[model samples]
Target: MAKKKKKTVAEDDLSAEDLGVVPEEKKKKTTAKKKTSKKKTTTKKKTTKKSSKKSDFIQSSCNVGLVGHVDHGKTTLVKALSGTWTEKYADEINRGITIKLGYAEAAVMQCPKCNRVIAEALANLLRKSKKDPKGHCPDCGEKLAFKRRISFVDAPGHEILMATMLSGASLMDGAVLLVAANEDCPQPQTREHLAALEIAKIENIIIVQNKVDSVGKERAIEHYNQIKSFVKGTIAENAPIIPTSAIFQANVDKISELIEEIIPSPDFEDLNEEDFLFNVARSFDINRPGISIDDLAGGVMGGSIISGQISVGDQVEIRPGLKNPDSGKYKPVITTVKSIYEGKHSLETARPGGLIAIGTELDPSNTRTDQLIGNVVGTPETLPEVKNTVEIETHLLEKVLGAEEDISVKPIAKNELIMIVVGTSLSAGVVSKIGKHNSVSLQLKRPICALGGSIVALSRRIHNRFRLIGYGYLAE
Candidate 1:
């Protein structure tokens, strides 16, 4: 009796219900394992959904031009902000200057804080945030999210390329005037670029004091003051000044924050409904020499849409288009927009206020070398009338810019030939008639698309090269 019968092997393996005695420890372990498996399955499903969501975070695109004197870090600042060196030309890289208009785009992101308090139980099971590249916040172990995307047009800041700067200015909703902290404020190009901004009426500006890392705090402060004074009484008088070291990416985040705050996308509710007006800045033959007829690409025009919207396959009429040698009269070039591209992003349609590249069906011979730079791409029969004779309400500046001597801006004399820039189009205009104070009518050598109140940049040859003298508005 003391030596009880050996417990049967079946009895030891009995189920809790069969044994009449509950196996509480085993039951708890089983429940815990099931819960963990469920949690893992739920987490994997959630992560799959979140990762599938496309990043259409860029709400609306705005062009912000970076303008300043040569060697002021305009290109460097662009590289810092967008991680791209805009100068793609060989000569530009060799010369260490932005020769043509450079372009880059970047997205500004922010950390996504944990909305739910990190409970001890849930903390270990939480997923990483999309906003924080590290997946988890170091402080509270949260995630991050994307904020906005901004496109920067890095314009050449050289004195000789003021025309290019002005052309780029026409596409900007705002501008960044870079002033190197190591150099004196109000460098010639800095002043000149600021003045050009004023003429273009670009009110939103951010003044960047770059190269601060190369100087001490005292020197940086001095440069800041110089910048404040230089901008005082000018268009950028109220603009914010952000000190940064573009070479080292110091305080570069501040610049991005400022851009998002100051250059908010424009309200295009009304403008988008109006007729389209695309200013052709640069056009080229993208086809290579060896390409066969079947594989040859069409002509590509790169520029910004000043107004309205254009979609793929839209029939557009280019005004003052390819001048037909046989017919002296200007003939409109009719073509369909084969494709539209904004930066590296492709789009089916393009709206006002962002740079776009349009591929068209046309003769490549007509587009190479920027021969069609100043043309307007618009709806057929809906574009503004092309004019060979333009009457302007001129307002001459007090002095000529980019000149060795501070020459006073003189009144337009009859028969004097001068350079004219309207939108992105450039032409030579001969003053045929002079009217009252700051009024003149000119006969243009190249026809241009002129609206009733379009602004025109006026320039004259002062020391061999043409210099910006003043701006004018198209007469009614």
Candidate 2:
């Protein structure tokens, strides 16, 4: 019997073979790099590894959301932190705002000289903005070393993109709500984004007073008061507010330090390994135009694992999947996990926490253009039941969120079509029956495979836009 070869990826290179881009010479070069990296880390003074493919590397331990109003420096802050830009879509680039959910990962680095786990984003900011180009410790000026990693989910903050933001929130373990110091505190989307986080039940929150470079200390102090007033009695009332300048890379150390302190990763060590469930945040067909059929790569899905672990060879099923053309009914798609990725880094096994991409054995066409968004993936027989209807124990807010002026939320009316966000899934549901105890039955336009007791965000079409109204829990 032949032993199975362990495949690895270089930190700087994407999984070339996974994307069908590996030439024979490139494969040998990659193998040589892998061999060299093992010895390379050994030579380093426990400070830095030029290659993340080294055995000592670890993936991001949690997903932190970079969320706020449009043009409020969410992307700028992500770039300041991770050194990776999230805007890739043509429309997003032209519009200069996040439309689809964006993702990036950064390592929490410690300075070997300081012997303290200093803020890595601070190191990243210094690397990008300072004379040393290579990142170093802010304290002792020594080379920074890897400690842990954190993934960032950059969600759109436009008024019309509330559903998209809610969908992104489902993947977050914590969130950083950006409020521009130059603008008035509690902008419409700022209020709504915080409410959305509350609906999603994210307790680890950080409020970033971004763009502080454009404001005076007096104005900044007033805005700080407004921020304090705005968050009073809310879930984020106690969330530390860090005044920042995302454009100039100021106070990122504070942000990174608070993230480490507030957002502790879930201790999934005791979680049952059999209960494997993953939410599909984004899916793509990575094959470029005019690729040969023989070398075409399979579909890829990016998301975070909610529970258990997934292996490279595991068979996974996507539920509430593609609609059957003949009957217009949804059907599940089963595929094998061909490869897994944390950014460009490949992994043989994955557990819950960081955002991951699973390369699957499926046709690229089916997964292109995010056709598989809002689908739940799990083992064939282990996935939760698909539901066309759900009963939610509704909790209505006092007023509609994301509105210019406060608008009182009307009670759920019969036959009222509303937008519902469950995990990464978003669908329109008609209020079919309103029973006692605010139990509302919704006939979903699209079927969703979600577990019971999941938190669902509700929105109403106000002025031709879906404004967040409140949240509810799937009734038992």
Q: How does each model score on TM-score?
A: 0.81, 0.88
What local lDDT score does residue 438 receive in model 2, on the 0 to 100 scale?
89
lDDT of candidate 2 over 1-476, digit per residue (tens): 12222132222123222222222233345567766777755646332454444455587789999888999999988888887778776677789998888888888877777665645655745654467646677666788877778999999988888888999999999999999988898899999999988888899999999888998999999999999999999999999999998877778877887888899887878763658999998777776454457666688887889888898899999999889889989989889998888876767789888988888888867877778889999977899889999999999999999989779999999999989999999999999999999889999989998888999999999988888998998875
Instruction: Compute the lDDT for candidate 1.
Output: 0.75
Question: Which portions of model 1 show Cα errors greater than 4 Å?
Answer: 1-60, 114-144, 326-329
Cα error, residue 181 of model 1, in Å, equals 2.0
Note each model's CA RMSD in angstroms.
19.5, 6.8
Candidate number with greatest TM-score: 2
lDDT of 1 by residue, 257-352 (tens): 678778877777898899998888877665544445765556678788777888879989999888878877788889988777666555677787
Ten consecutive residues with minimal summed lDDT in candidate 1? 11-20
Look at candidate 2 and tell me the lDDT of residue 345: 73
